[model samples]
Target: MRSTTYYAHGLNIKSELFFPEFPLKQTSEIDVIIRFGITNLFNDSSKNFREIYLSKFIQIKITSCNLLYLFWNDIQIFTIKNNEIIINPNTGLDLNYIKFLLFGYGFAILLYLKGRLVLHANAVDMDNSAVVISGVSGIGKSTLSFAFHQKGYKLLCDDVLSINIGKKFQIVYPSFPRIKLWPDVIKNFEEDPEMVPKIHDKTSKRFYNVSGNFSDIKKQIRAIYFIKVTGDIKIKEINPQKAMMELIKSSYCYKLLNHHEISENLSQCSAIVNKVPVKILEVKKSYESLNKLVEIVENDILKN
Candidate 1:
């Protein structure tokens, strides 16, 4: 099969499998390579691997050679070594499901291995700088990002944020131009949920392609917000000390990090808190208040 080149998170990726989510790029220098192959890490007789993470949907193991194995039941298996990812998919498995796994969890782990600070957050370009919004699952992070996109702000990324921490500044790289939304949220946007493509067969979630309003270049981070559902809309700045802890908790694939990576993560988080403003955004749980929330955040960011 002919290979394709794509760019995301500041890396040039050459892959055998097609990734509809990523923007195509023509580059001779490749930072990562992904190919389809049969993975046998689970059946290896050496047994030098140790299981590091286990969840209902996925399991991870690492070998002494630094090879990471990600298993998604019998449907798909991935072996990540160096800058290469080998994917093994079961026969008759839908390509959409494979793409979902490769782009989400698989790519997050790959970014972590490459020594990038990854956050489980939604990022948007606000006034030439990046602003991040993070919260627990189903807490409207993507919804808020969509609101920003609708208001003429360019979206940087959704779900996984990759950052390059410098001595005095941190830059956030754009990850594709896609946002996942629930069926009801689609309806709130005056769009037919059934008309949109589902993220996976197991869920009613749909993805919106926003390539037209995507910020493809990297941007300096201006602020970070940890949101919660509250009775009213309020935005309070967090101190550096407390903000560091919150950033650590919001890291992507944090549970899978080893001790050394955890220490590095702590140092990186500290740097981020000191350089950018971190705040607590209290928002009501009603979609009707989305505009108000966006206005409040925009004003707050502008004032700083």
Candidate 2:
């Protein structure tokens, strides 16, 4: 019983991290097995991880850092690698820590497992389907995501987008459900000062409980808007490859990593480019820019 198994077209996967480099295959024989490294967040860094290899879609990885926790829908599983950690079965998994990881960005890795290689992008729901705004981190992924949320659009996930690639590709995951806003950004959204979550560190964390109906609905991989918050007030489509290149460069599109990582990145990117239409959406640096961009998506691109 293993959490994941990896078999690549070129390399023999020595570690589970290399498994993702291999495209998805349905087989009974396991080439590489990963007994999910699960550990408690409150637990000491020296603690060991619980090893259980089961087949299902999950998004935790064993990299340079320790494995904290993993989410499968609503269920949360905590772990202690190498060491045994028994949590109260009643308490189940820790939601408080999920909020923290959302801020720190553990969800991006999970998005990879589920199918999409998400960058520090942002997304919001419009006319039922979701619209994703992708660009470099400070280019207003969060700011645009929040602005749309204010204008009655449902926030899906920020920073991570789940993409499914094989033949026909699609972005299947909700928008980054939670948002981490700066102190100044918080004041505009919070009517009551006490409504905010507990503050422990310098970063202010805010969690937006996504709707079950919306989360389950895999939003069609509509146009990927490359966000450039320039002083220019313009919203239109540009060359698709040019738009894709911006996301690839900014997100460290690791297709050039190693053969294994490259293979995986290629497998994912090819599907994305072939399936979804990429566009360049440039606007002046303002919250209202998102709305103007949406007008183009709804009127110009998807409508056509």
Candidate 3:
């Protein structure tokens, strides 16, 4: 059986984020392990599949899906047919619907099971620390994430960040370059036409999907920045308790976990608070302001 180390980092509390699971058990086999989280897991937009699915990934569909919890019936797992699949009730993952969930989906599952992630958000290694930027949607997280990259900080991730907690909150995620910025805001970064994709509106806002030169730079979470979007721009430091709240508010997939397994998400964030410093990055509408904020983070975080 092939195995690997697993990590979990939550938003409000700290917990052991390891769960030993076999890889073959995950694929090409009937044996299965299921987990649960703190949310409904099955969110119904009733807005139809079009609004729910992305414009880039419309090829896959789930017209007839069974959106029920695996734990809706039992306590301990029981054996089904040798070819049948068992489910994790507390997790929002719907194994019956598809072959595998994306990275975000898997991360959410790990958190639900109270498993920590080895990496998270947009982070960079500076003097042996992982400076990380995290926030809710439309909070200029991407603006700040890529800014560090431009300043010679290796870009780690764009949208989602995960942290693995053992000795501390060791951040982890696959190599991803560039950030998704508002179409109108792309010009400030010297918008390279080649990097910008065709502008498309998914939910009334224009999305500029862009790419960067370095796409394989991954690192740990040395610092945490909660980008706060408002009518103006500013930067400040918050206490650990407040930092934990912001972490929860900016949690990657907390609400998406309908199965009520939120212990892990909380645990990951707690680990960060206990070990790393979490800060607040307030930004205004102007990209110049964003630049100033970036400079502050780089000067303070990257240098120290």
Model 1 CA RMSD to the hidden true structure, in angstroms: 1.7
Which segments of model 1 are wrong by more than 4 Å? 42-46, 74-76
- All candidates: CA RMSD (Å): 1.7, 11.2, 11.4
Q: Residues 12-130, candidate 2, lDDT per residue (tens digit)?
A: 22232222212344556643233334444446464554422222533332323434354444344433222221222333435454334433344344334333565656666776666
TM-score against truth, every candidate: 0.95, 0.60, 0.57
What lDDT, from 0 to 1, does candidate 2 have? 0.50
Cα misplacement distance, residue 281 of candidate 1 (Å): 0.8
Model 3 stretches with alpha carbons more than 4 Å out: 1-114, 117-121, 124-128, 192-195, 198-218, 230-233, 256-260, 302-304
Cα lDDT computed for each candidate against the true fold: 0.87, 0.50, 0.47
**Across residues 1-304, which tens digit of lDDT does each residue of candidate 3 receive?**
2232222122211112222211111233222223232322235333232112212332212112322222222221211111122233434334322212322343343343344443235565455456677766566666676666666655555555655666744655433333456545556667654455432322223224323433343356667777777655556879888988877776654543333336766676787788777887777767677668877776766454
TM-score of 3: 0.57
Judging by lDDT against the true structure, name the best candidate: 1
Candidate order by decreasing lDDT: 1, 2, 3
